[model samples]
Target: MAQLTVDIIRARVEEDWTRIVEVLNRKIALQSISAKGITAEHMKRSAEFVAEQLREVGVDANVVQSHNPDGTPGAWEVTGSKIVDPGAPTVLLYAHHDVQPVPDESAWRTDPFVGTEIDGRLYGRGAADDGGGIAIHCGALKALGDELGVNIKVFIEGEEEMGSPSFIPFIESHRDEFAADVIIVADSGNWSADIPSLTTSLRGNTDIDVTIKALEHPVHSGQFGGPILDANTLAAILIASMYDANGDLAVPGIVAEDPIGGLQRDLDEATVREDSGALASYRFAGTGSLAARMWTKPSVTVIGFDAHPVEGSFNVISPQTTFRLSLRTSPNQRPEEAQEALAAFLVEHAPFGAEVSVKRGENGMGWAMDPNAEATKDALAAMQEAFGVTPINKGEGGSIPFIPELQRIFPAAQVLVTGPEDPKANAHSPNESISLPGLKNNVITEALLLAKLAQ
Candidate 1:
């Protein structure tokens, strides 16, 4: 075996890129959708598939599962280890095998379960969200074969999209085995196909179910509509109060920051509009830099609403209406505080003396890390060399609850967040995809980072 260098690793990854893509396509075809819970056999098949890939690269791999309160198997996990030296610094590679459900298959240009490549991007249900992350880990392992100098642990989660119900239990059960000096989370996106980035911040999220009741039961609209307001109208009034004139969230106690001076890159407004698929005449919400509005400021969205359908004609005052609010808090704000504040706001502002019931749902804490940390510097340098451009520090509006958990369990470990996704990946949507060139570059970057860690 020869010494591992950036040039050597890049060449190996390029030489074996075709096989890597094939493995990802095979993984994508399993239909391991776990968002609705991990009951499907395909989810286990996905874990076995990841273990097999690790074993191919000389890792001692196994398909493991977390236990429920009654000691029964809950969610599946694939874990493996490859140790070049007993005393060497160990690095853990993290990526999820589970994917979001394909609610509307008719909206897909290509089959959601079939990985199809068109115009240098591979489209599939999990192609970019996480299958690409798995490919990057495997490609790096294969590229650094024989000459690898550090210990590595691979953990491919099987229930992340379903909010990782068994994540904490599993980690606590195998804490010693998986503990490492560095943790590489390959589940975020890059700045662009040509520009690489290291994600350092993630916003937290909490969902609140607000039900407004104005009447005890249905009543004739023609008779009682004059004095008493309908529940629908009251619900509308409460939802409308979430935003101010500038369309920014007016929720009190939620933290917000202007990231203009801190961000390494500027989010182009035109690009945001195009990427969001917004109408030409549509207006954006909030204030400050687009990056700050998305990455640091609080935002509220109505994810689910319940009301009578127009198809069934009804001319009556509704008793109550329920709306689910998905609130994204700032990276530094506590989710509990945000949830309490929003609930209080809704109760205080209840319209027309309507009875307001706020039921709290899922709440996940946000995460933030210094980009100039030792391991992060190595990752950024590797990305810069591999992508042939200066890498940037980025923040994600999406919440990865498990990342914060990882930090809690292994406080000493340096968590470096990187991925193969680009802006156009469209993860979790109809046309989810991963850039082929971008994936290759990510593989090289990981291989270089691993080699650098050994020194």
Candidate 2:
């Protein structure tokens, strides 16, 4: 790598910092919630906005459309300036434009759809998790359009928060256009406010709905007392069997060992509990290293329950009960295998005379990247030059279903993950925000990366 002037890059970032923030806030003001999955209108508006920005920078930009599995129109891709050499290694910059829905408006400090800034933080629904990241990439491209002399493509998805169901099909249909030597996913966050990090792995996820049935109809408790089999009681027993006294998962086939080389050093237990808003004396399940249990082990959560409330309770035995189960599996673990393990456990341990039924939903695989790849090295170097610090290799517990698909299609490409969020970004929660300093630094880093990749 040739020696680059750091001062020049910093100056470019500062020159356009305010404009970048304005663009991000403006887009946030437009509600493009894709929680129920991406609609045709959402794709259209996002594509137009991105293309307009690229055009303003004197770069040729266009959108490529694809269809969903239901034969309905799906997402659109925004591709920027092309490379002179067709065989030269190309880089793809990826971010999702869609955001999760804000169901409870009254819970937020400001309008969830309206972007607001206070105390150096930009507050909005998608400000940190994704929208802010997209802005950083666009700002970087605009600032270094001429200096970054390589082929670059920007593929923004419209259905990431909804599990990216249409993204795999889109990639399959446009393999040639999406092909690249390196893919940078600006969707993850740093370990802390000052600690830079690169996410190298993500956990897989699966969901199941369990139902227990006892009788055909509800019977009065006065007449059937001590004789009727209560569905609610059976459901309680089954759920209780999922964990042991130590709070560790008691199910078979789920690995619970410490991770290789241990976990992150700054992952304090207090901070974890505080961030998750746990009770004052609450404790996490399992034992051993925190990172290992979270990133490399399996975790089960009871997401929802269907039952009669005490306020509306009648003196009768309920006929049915249902609950939802969510599982997070480690990298290299098979979703099918985990699903089967959980199902078998419930089947064998179900209470006597009670029929237990389990239904599975869409399952996605986990991902782990090669940290020593050339593109990753270049990205790290570029980030170091831009931020004046080295980035730590890390793993994320959340899953992105489209990542595994992208790797499958472009088997040889390196995937680099980093973004503008820190530990306090509060993505997916009330009052979500992004730090202005973090956004500006990310813009500088991405611009430097473009120039480095072109070299």
Candidate 3:
């Protein structure tokens, strides 16, 4: 393998961004909401489009489908051509085509289904989250093949937003076909808009719905106030007990370790509040650096609560109340163990005579990359060469369930999480957007990294 020149890679990326944006916009226009998932028609169209583009660039590409157990739309894979060298290390580039649902149209400034460009940012649902990253990877490969004569396989899944339940089965069935020396997950964002980042850890997640039942129906609150058990109040008490005053999770057996350090930065509270749509006075619990508190500690958030309405002022004791609890465990914790601890806490802490039931939802283990891996070194070098800045290693607070599965299947493979997205990309939220500059940088970096991996 020949040494890749940064200037050549940058030039190729500059030449390809225009076409890449067009293709990405086309893909984003289709509503591939994972909650509704990708329709057969939509998947077929997307696959066809990708296949055509690969052929146009004189690369071998094809859409491989894996059927669901019941014979539904199980999973889909798009494989590209190999680099010239027969022994070149195969690199699997992973992205997801599916996105979360757009609940309210009025919440968006532009059509969520339509990709809109405003103030140098492309606005759409999945623009930055995964679409931009996907485009960068595909575009970089295309440009490298045409301009630098390199090749890499591309594997984009359609169920990532849905916890990627189908990914493991797909990988297991097609293990040989998906073999890679390293995997580049371009679904994360940088530490900040300007600073490049490689995510080294991801917290695991578990969902539990706790329901408390006391009375059969709503009774007059004034009359029943004295002794009658209020399900809502009981539920609140149970929920509140899950956290200590310091904002640290009170769940048993879940240890909160100090973050690896160095990822800490003084985040402006005002900026955080504005970005998170919280009041200026809004504050997070726990003591530590923001990054440490966010990515290292266990967090318990009551995502959903079911109770009586405030408008009705229902002077009654509610029969039943339920709250959906989402637990983000530490990087090394097992989600199932966390779930068990949570269930036990809720069950043992329930109010007297109140029936409390805990139902476990989806659970996934966290992922922590080996910092000493060779592939990581190559990736860092590639990023430095492309962006002229060393990449920052950090941890994402959210869970990408499939990462653990991938790690289990390919224990020796190095996994690096770097992408085109940024902090302000508004991923999983309204008016999500991606910076054009970031997209271009990702293309260049990925292209250079592909060359490095091949070497």
Candidate 4:
């Protein structure tokens, strides 16, 4: 803590690239997709693999089991621990091994299960969010050996992508096991490939499934064309009502909080275009700063639909239409209230008195960290020292539902969100990747932060 040499930390990461890649490669090879696999057995095996690796570095590592609220098997948590001093605060290293399903199989430049490197970027489904994180945790422990400034715990989660259904329950059951003064979540992305960022806020998420029905059975389009109303059309109209001409969510009572003063930075158009795959001819939706629109506001997208197949001959008015909606809410917005307003809008505005049912799916509240907290400042200073650049306060558009729960469990603990993925990492999408530089630099940042926090 008293003295930190940049070159030494840099060399530590560089020298361990072989083992790092090995850990990540093994994790990538495992299809621990919690959403698709209800039992999550793959998660348990993956956690054991990580624990074995952590044990190689003298950490007391083991796999802990916890169940989801519905009694299903939740993600397995791999915990590795060491204590340099009993008095110093413990630092919890957090990340997940579960990954999102590939959007399109043909879109992958390389096998999604095989970790491959091209032009200095590792390409794979969970390479960045957060197989890379697993590597970083192992690498950092290997570097630190038994000389850590404070006690350290590495927590590798298995059900993060499934919105962490049982995270609250697990945290509550193992309150003493998770005791720590600071938490560093490595499931976030940086501002860019070259820039560093500290995620200060995360937007909450809610899923709403709606089904509209007009008649019990379909009627011939030609026979009842003028008089009969199709459920698909009514559903479409109600969906369109969610947005105004300006493209912002027009649903009544949807909350949008202002960006933290002096913390917001409007993303540049060129970067947004490249990162978002937006074409020049396409117009941007929503109002206000791009950062605010993405990070702190409510955004909706139609994620699933049940309708007639385009290739199938359907010359009949459909009797029912079902759709799944995903809503990202502001940090402080009440999830149930927003869901109630949205359900009311769809049912109240149903076309021709069509029956509409909006079923609320899983929901998670967002979190805002105190930027000026001592642990945050210590980690910020460590990041700047590691990269030779000042890291900016950033808000992640994605949701880590357990963050708010973790805060509730440890109200006095400081949470600092950091990760290795960049904008081009494309997490939760095809060709998800992490650059060599970013991977090494972020690991060094975490290692340095742990040391400084011990001080």
lDDT of each: 0.88, 0.77, 0.77, 0.82
Ranking of all candidate structures by their lDDT, best first: 1, 4, 2, 3
lDDT of 3: 0.77
lDDT of 3 by residue, 247-275 (tens): 67777877676554345455556676776
TM-score, prediction 4: 0.87
- Tens digit of per-residue lDDT, candidate 2, span 227-320: 6768888888898898889777888986554443335463678888887788987767777677877777778888998988889788898888
Which portions of model 4 show Cα errors greater than 4 Å? Answer: 15-18, 29-45, 70-74, 100-107, 111-114, 211-229, 260-264, 310-320, 351-356
The better candidate by TM-score, 1 or 4, is 1
Is candidate 1 or 3 superior in lDDT?
1
For model 4, residues 8-87, the per-residue Cα lDDT tens digits are 77787788878887778888888667777634567778778878988897789888877888877667878778877789
Once fitted onto the true fold, the runs of candidate 3 whose alpha carbons sit more than 4 angstroms away are: 30-37, 81-83, 100-116, 146-151, 213-224, 260-266, 311-314, 352-355
TM-score winner between candidates 1 and 3: 1
TM-score of each candidate structure, all chains considered together: 0.91, 0.89, 0.89, 0.87
Error of 1 at 399 (Å): 1.4
Give residue 422's error in model 1 in angstroms: 1.5
Candidate 2 stretches greater than 4 Å from native? 1-3, 35-43, 104-106, 110-115, 213-229, 256-262, 352-354
For candidate 2, list the clashing residue pairs, or say none. Answer: none
Residue 273, candidate 3: Cα error in Å is 1.5
Candidate 2 overall Cα lDDT vs. reference? 0.77
